[model samples]
Target chain A: MPIDEALLERMLLRESVSEFLYREADLLDERRYTEWLDMLAEDYQYSVPLRMNVAFGETDAREETRAGREICWFDEGKETMSLRVDQLNTGLHWAEEPVSRISHLVTNIRLDAVELPEVAVSCRFLVYRNRVADETDFLVGRRKDRLRQVGDSWHVVRRELLLDQSVLLAKNLSIFV
Target chain B: MTTVEEPTRTGAPQVRNLVDVKNGEISREIFIDEQIFKNELENLFPRAWLFVGHATQVPEPGDFFSSWMGADPVLLTRDDKGELNVLLNSCRHRGMRVCRYDEGNTLQFTCPYHAWSYSIDGSLVDTPGALHGVPQQKAAYGTNLEREKWGLVRAAQVHNYKGLVFANWDPEAPSFDEYVGDFHWWLDNLADAFDGTEGGTEAFRGVHKWRIRSNWKFVSENFLGDTYHGASTHASVEAVGIGPGGKGKRRHGERQNEGGFSKGRMKTSFRRGHGASDNLAYEIPYPEFEEAELDEYFVAAWEKRKEKLQAEGRLLGGRGPATLFPNMSFAAGFPRTILVAHPISPTETEVWRWYLVDKSAPEKVRDWLRHYYMRYAGPAGMTEQDDMENWDYATEASRGVVARRYPYNYQQGLGQETASDLDGSVHSHHAIAGEVNARAFYRRWAEFVDNLSWPELTELARVDDRATERDAVVTDVAEGVKVLDAVDVVDGPPAQ
Candidate 1:
């Protein structure tokens, strides 16, 4: 069935938001955290919930139930994210001293219109990082982003990352993805 | 010299007596030998109350996490009734891992190969194939299968002291308090430093796990001492102005004298292999917080801790990077707790790093602590990477025929341990550059690995009863418990 004009506009808006996310990923990959932070709303909520199989043959994974109640890999607010970035820039963060070069590949973008007038965009990401004299550490996951339009630019208000591996291989999440 | 006789294959040579450990320096064979490592898994890890994941990890009902004790896979879970359980990860039917993931919240664990299901409490729930063909499916693989017996082999003894959960495989081993000995005070000090205040100590989210190739003992020894290396191998770090400076023959001396350069403090070693070092330096030393105001609670905690130390006839020493025997270590200055447990192989050890923060502190403080922890200790941390590089190189080097033959030296301060009257604490003049802590650690290591029975080991430890008594007093003070007015000189406390 052919979609309506309004529906098409919403889809386009969602796609644009998804594109902005890719740009954000690019900024992070380029170690441009300050630029990436600009894409986030002041009250942004970023979280990477620790994934688990609750029961056999169960699907329709609920984000809140999985993340809020259980363990989360990364649960941070804007202030925390800022602090992390600040630490990275300090040059004394021994963890990031020999900084790992990262490349973030985001793809398979999908958008869902929610009741709150905010678009929920889901995309898969592969963040590859290589530290000095060490093998590459790969982090492959899906990011569910809730983006809202504020003035002329779209801002990411919420993000819930779902990683494929239960045990993270990276020594640390010193870098933002 | 009496020749040590080898025992028959059936009878394991009567494991070395603990009292005999004073024969000069211990040979490096103890760290590298496969047989010794195997015995350790069976004896030490099993008998000792090894630290496991915190209760916070499996807070909710149905939450589960997998951990290991020397190589034994354990599934730590919270049942539907909200009770904590540590069970063997192996499936009872086919011996496959029931829970494969490192951590998760789940109602039941179903084996991937077979459709056999077990509850979060490790009760066998259902077997699809069995019900179809066999009339007595319940009898074969059902709840009647002595759920407790078949569910999962629970750690023989599981106990928690201040949010830290530890498990033991030996039923006869002393209580966790006794096992902890004077070290309990150090743990209490760590908790008290951040706890009892408004928010208490909140375990910052996320755990960093990595592999270091050196013998686990080597890593423990490094944390224990080897402060000598900071000025040399890490000179590049100093060149970049990240670590301590003052290069020359008197580099350590210069740093120690110039308080600005040396920002950390090492503590006197206690009986039962517990000691701590504190780095007043940044937990996540970045320019971001250079001008930021300090938290009142953090400063107060330090003051209170120092006061307590002073009252106990001990100096209000510097910050602590505290270590409890066998595996656990904590950096009180950063309020970071690290537990590195040895796994199956001597060459392979898993490191679990926790960024412990004052729970009462503002969300921003917790955030900073997390960031700092990630920056310094996490897999991505520069110092951690450097340490891993050295560990990997050491492990590789140890495997070589020539390197294996060469004695790995630990003779940095062979005879320079000076006795101090202050709380009977032994002080090394060159604290950073000395091997006193390492030597002390190895001395305790040999005592533990000598394979004496628990009671026998305790008896041998009493040889320096005064040190043990001092340790107990400090521990009491650290734990915030009423200091015992008198010492009861007895073993096992008359069995209840």
Candidate 2:
């Protein structure tokens, strides 16, 4: 059976979102904060939940309980993002001071329909960061992004990055993926 | 007539005199030397009350999370009976990690290597291949090993105060309250400020783990004493108007132009290594929001705390910034807590920060606090990023042959430290510069590194003459506060 027009449109949206993500990665890797900032909505929300070892066979990968859900790290809004970008631009931001060359490879894009209009998009991503003075540290994770079509462009309303490793090898998370 | 015993161990030096504290700058050997590292793993780590995860991490009966103490993996789980248990993550048969994942809810943990299963309580439930292969079946493997004795080793002591869990390997260490000492007051203030009506606040998942190349002490000292670097190192933040503006512009309520503000801030250090710089009254300056907007929250919390203090017949007008000895530290009123844990070598440390908000607070308050915290303190936080860069460089620089030759100079305010106006608090005139807080930390470090028994260490600390000047200031301040209180009643509560 041929794909429906609505399905085709959805696929196009997915592709566009994926392309935008790659472009965003490129902007960050190339140190283009201005361009990167332009891509974000003024009220965009970004968060990376701390991954923990949950019991086997449980479907709820992210635990948000009062006691067990500790925030390992996160960025809440655009103002924070501006501060971070500004720090990076200056000779400050010691974590990334020397600046690590980063390559974010995003692949295996899969779209699952949870409900109409709000699709769950999952992609495999491997981020390699090479600090100028230290050994390279790599992070591989699955990005579960909630993309919404706001007019012509797709904006990331919510994103959950689930990293495979619980004990991270990187010294500090000064970079964003 | 006294006889001195000669040191038998080749690398082990004789116990030096307490007066030798002057020479006790942390040696790079503590970070790099394999022997010293081993000694620390055996001696320091196993003895101290190492922080584990918060109780919230394992909320439900079956909920569990895995963590590490040095190299030893441990599983923190809530059992079938809902009791929190910290168990070694090793299997009985071949010593494999029972649960490999970081956290989850489960009835039991099964070893993948040999299929040995264990209940959440660390009781061996089944040995898959034992009954069929062994002639004695249950006798050979199951019934022979006492399930209680053979199960995972529980931490020596696991306790929590206000949802924060800590475990110590030493059974004889001071009680949690005693170990916390004056730091307990800071924790109380923090817990009291929490807006959560349902007992305590929750940590959002997503730990940003990264390594820095410097000694663990460097990280601790940096956080403990280096507020001086904030304006200079984070100039970018100022340029972007995220943090304090450069030169004379005060970003927060902090009076950047006044020398006394910095000095008054530095003088606030608690006994037992807990200390905070700037904001002597444990209040984090709020430059982001207008005073009118913040007054409701701050005044309400402060008024409640003041009433509690008054009922207890204590002074509430001033209590300095907060710090917990060894690892944990916080700016309480700001509602941010940093828990720093040493994971591997002394040079390697893991920093975890929680943006604490009152549980009963409005969603907007929580959201705003989360936003502010992330902007300044989180892994991607501008200020934190600036600090991390310096940390990474400090670590890298320490590894250099020439740089290692010189001892890190923490003598910024050395002899000039003033005592707190209250008991068990120390102060410095300049909060921005490194001062008594750093000295206090190093003094405690010398005590720990010298391997003094707990009682002996406490005794020696009490008699140590270096703190006399600070102590005098504390006594005078306490007395002065008392006089101020008496006059406050007569003055009819001054102008608001």
- State every prediction's TM-score relative to the real structure: 0.67, 0.79
Write model 1 residue lDDT over A62-85, tens digit each, in one string: 222243322255555686566556
Provide DockQ values for all models, in the order shown: 0.12, 0.41
lDDT of 2 by residue, A75-141 (tens): 4666566666766777655567567899989999877654544556789889999977456878898
lDDT of 1 by residue, B1-496 (tens): 1112265353433334221223334444555667667766766666767777777777788777677766778877777666676777777767888776666676777677665566654243432111112225586758555443455466777886666777888788888887666455456545544423322455554555555556776666656545555543443333333211111112111233323123223234544555443221112121112324444545565566556555665443333455666776665444356666566477767776665666566655555555444434544543355566566556656665454444455565455443433232343333354455555665666556556667887765544433333333233222211111132211110000
Write one digit per residue (lDDT tens) for candidate 2, span B1-496: 0111254354443223221235434444444444445655665666667666767768887787777665577888887566677777887668888787767777777677766556664233432111112234375667665544455667778887777777877788877876666556556655554321223455545444555565666566665655666666766655565423222233233433332232233345655665655433433333334435454665565566566666777543222234556665555544355456564765666665555666666555565566555555645665556666676666766666665455555566555545554445555544455456766775665456556688876675453255574444333333433443444321110000
The reply for model 2, stretches above 4 Å from the true place, is A1-25, A61-75, A108-123, A144-160, B1-26, B78-83, B106-137, B141-144, B194-208, B241-263, B268-271, B278-295, B315-323, B421-425, B469-496
lDDT of residue B35 for candidate 1: 66
